[model samples]
Target: MSTAHAYYPSAPMPITMPQKPGYYPTPAHHGYGRVSVSPPQAESVTTSGGASYEPSATSSSYAGSASEYDSSGTNTGVDLLDYMGDRLHGAFDPVPLDRSLAKQAQTSGELNAKHRELLELQALAQRRLAGARANFADGMRAAKEVQKDLQWTQKRVDALNERAARKYPAEYKSAQNRYPAPVDY
Candidate 1:
């Protein structure tokens, strides 16, 4: 007859230690040395003010179940072709009736609007240039008049100096005595 050992659920498992000294000592104790080595009791996590959270039966399977894309997610072949055609035509094909060209044509009537604008700008610039030329000519004339006035004033001063020397011979002689004429002159 075979004998079966009885199992005791309440008893802790036995651990064997090494017999020789210095060969293998006991494992270095953790924070609590030589203390009882039993499995830690399960801790109950609670919220603030000691409120325990108990999940409802329906909550376990409800996450992300209702959120989903529409069933008609696949694109039809015709829709894809139309989308592709639109993109291709927009990239490669020239527009037949451009609004900008139509607007220009309508505004210009017979002459090109851009060309007319250029001509108007050129005429305005020409008018400005002519006015600038007239102003420059007037400035030159004023400068010449000022030069003529300055020459007349200089000639009058020279005449006055000569008359003063002629009228006062004694004073002129005294001035000459003080400052003799240059030898070269």
Candidate 2:
């Protein structure tokens, strides 16, 4: 702004940032003292967006700091326009790539390859399922037939043992004494 229209006061106005919870800047760390123009009051203001804050000090009373400020109210130090235009230039330039992002990208690429392998395995399983089912069915039928024949032969051996025990007791008892049945079946 031109000198005539500039809102920049001769004395720097208290910089008021939005108040944050659990954080209050003291003069020691922030390097700026607090200013209150009038007696402290229980007052607050709400913005249009519904944020509430303590009002800025109004009117005029600087406590015992009257001698510290220039009574004449004149310009001091560098111009605001020059400081903003020149010194604040490089703050908005693009930042370099962060290392964490590179690591994340590498892990994501590896996971993608693993996911592709799993997809291929799923497809192979789908392709071979019909042939595998057919082979299993054939094997099942053969196993059942062999099991049935084995059961039939076992029943015949048991029946023969029962007949020999009843019809030829004398000889059967002698045979039993010499060699006992291998199994009850």
Candidate 3:
């Protein structure tokens, strides 16, 4: 079975008072400078018949304290260990090569000569490649321009043909009429 309650229609609703000033004071020694801490009050749940219910005080304080205290903890021994671990692991190891292998490597004079030769060859190849590429690009561009010019010339010839037909229709007709179709043998 369930029970239900109803409030009187004419009754005045309850009112809550304004919060107190300086309710939260800063801790002087912490050096964080004037941080306010206000504990949240437990809300009163009121039934329709004016029956008020409050949650447990201990439970309410726990929520507030959890939020307030949640932060990065101070640099402890574990932190120091982690930092030392990172520093040690992050460092690059010194590479050791065989002295005999190094001695067997190419001589400095020979290396310098080869390097110079390589540089000279690279420079010559670069110049030739650049010249070839430039020539190719220029040729392509010129071909495009020539194609455009030929199209323009064709357009001009067509215009001229149309103008000649309008201005000298008789001559135009005569020229077309004179050119007879050849009979295939």
Candidate 4:
């Protein structure tokens, strides 16, 4: 269990008390900052609706398997308080402190491994985001370039059409007769 001094001092400090009239003394040390502790892990048999964290036969009492709890009267799959009370009072064989410490160390190791994996994933996500941003920029540039090219091509085609009308008047007139200009709205 973790312990820390509470806010709102319970007793007045001797150092803070003024020694003489109109003599204000500064505190040698500051107040204790926030002491954040990780929330207690739930002692659930199952983890987030996943596989059971069944203790070994020696580690636990009154159990054939984790699933056997449903059939057993001792454990109704509820009443965490009662379950802990039973363990504390030795209703079932108590787990050794050293063994419990080892279990905790193992759990810490697993958590560290998971943390590393998560960090790697975060790095990968950052890389992907950077790549996506670059690709977007490249695509935008390409689109703008294509639009400019299309405008230039259209201008060139109009110039060619004008030239054709002037140079091949007879042919152009025949073509215009075959395909009349579209009516404006």
Candidate 5:
């Protein structure tokens, strides 16, 4: 609400006289200052399409929700009035303030819980990854040991064949003639 004073020494201090709905005083009339326009009355506004609408929602079903919005006379001196100064147009209306706030709080709590759960899952995945890496390293070491054992056995077989060929060339030559290829162990 703008409190720009419209003073006339002959009339009143603020000129509390009601002005027309859309009418505005010139800057010169109000001493070249800003003037606040009055609010529209609690009436239906008509459009060019012959349609009209009320400012606030009003219905027979409003009775059920009215109890939720009505104040318990706890607020003492606050003047709650609409633009047209209608009591029925202002404070009596009920809103879902409390229930909406509670729902919002519940949603916030659920979101926080989900965030915590996601963090825990990520941590567990990291631990599992570390364990898998360690297991893979151990398996590679074991494979290297097995390869070393296989190489040692193949070396011993070749050494034994060389010794036999030198000690008994005639016998080895006859065996080679009989079996041209090396025998499988």
Candidate 6:
């Protein structure tokens, strides 16, 4: 088997794009885009007498009372000129506004939103820190208990050695000469 080291680029290569001209539809100053103000085209109809006549606007299906239109105040049935005329005749009122006050309110609202996010992150960090500290304390207590148990065991072993030396003095002295006491105990 061949041992080959694979190399990977740390960053991707930059892409080069050709510059081209782009077109966008022009937007109207008011209302929906590009309103058509042209009059409707008439369709010619031939009767049994072979005479052709164009249809009239009033003869169409929409020739009814003004109230027959939608009552939502939109006046979709009215002509564009008439609609604009009615609107200009004090049908709508302009409200006075202080732009500086509006800007200040918006900034304060954004500041409050950011402050809430900061507090949430701070609370999460505090909870994680508390958990880490508690875990560390529990580990330290466990290590201390293990050390205490080791000291108790070492004391018991020393006591057994003392008893053995007293009971058989001749053999104990020879064993002591071969292996000295451990320095830590």
Task: State how far residue 182 of model 5 sits from its true place (Å).
Answer: 9.4
Q: On residues 7-103, what C-alpha lDDT tens digit does candidate 1 reach at each position?
A: 2222222222213333323333331112222322222234444422333311222122322211132211123333344556558645555866887
Structural similarity to truth (TM-score) of each candidate: 0.32, 0.37, 0.31, 0.40, 0.42, 0.36
**Local accuracy of candidate 4 as per-residue lDDT tens digits, 1-185:** 22222232222222111123222332223222112122222232333464333333123332333543232232222233333444455564546877899999999999999999999999999999999999999999999999999999989988987999999999999998999877979
Task: Give all candidate RMSDs, comma-separated.
Answer: 28.9, 18.9, 27.2, 31.1, 19.6, 28.5
State residue 150's C-alpha deviation in candidate 4, in Å.
1.2
lDDT, candidate 1, at 85: 49
lDDT of 3 by residue, 1-185 (tens): 22323222221222222223333332334324222233344444344445343444224442454544432332111233333444564573434345545655646667889999999999999999999999999999999999999999989988998999899999999987898445779
Clashes of each: 0, 0, 0, 0, 1, 0
Compared with the true structure, all predictions reach lDDT values of 0.51, 0.54, 0.54, 0.54, 0.53, 0.55
In order of TM-score, best first, we have 5, 4, 2, 6, 1, 3
For candidate 6, lDDT tens digit of each residue in 103-163? Answer: 8899999999999999999999999999999999999999999999999998999899999
Model 3 scores a C-alpha lDDT of 0.54
Error of 3 at 12 (Å): 99
Model 2 whole-model lDDT (C-alpha atoms): 0.54
Q: To one decimal, what is the Cα RMSD in angstroms of model 2 from the true structure?
A: 18.9
Q: Candidate 1: which stretches are off by over 4 Å?
A: 1-111, 168-185
lDDT of 6: 0.55
Q: After superposition, how far is residue 77 of candidate 5 from its true place, in Å?
A: 13
Off-target runs (Cα >4 Å) in candidate 5 are 1-95, 168-185
Task: Name the Cα RMSD for model 6.
Answer: 28.5
Tell me the spans in candidate 3 whose CA falls farther than 4 Å from its real position: 1-119, 176-185
TM-score of 1: 0.32
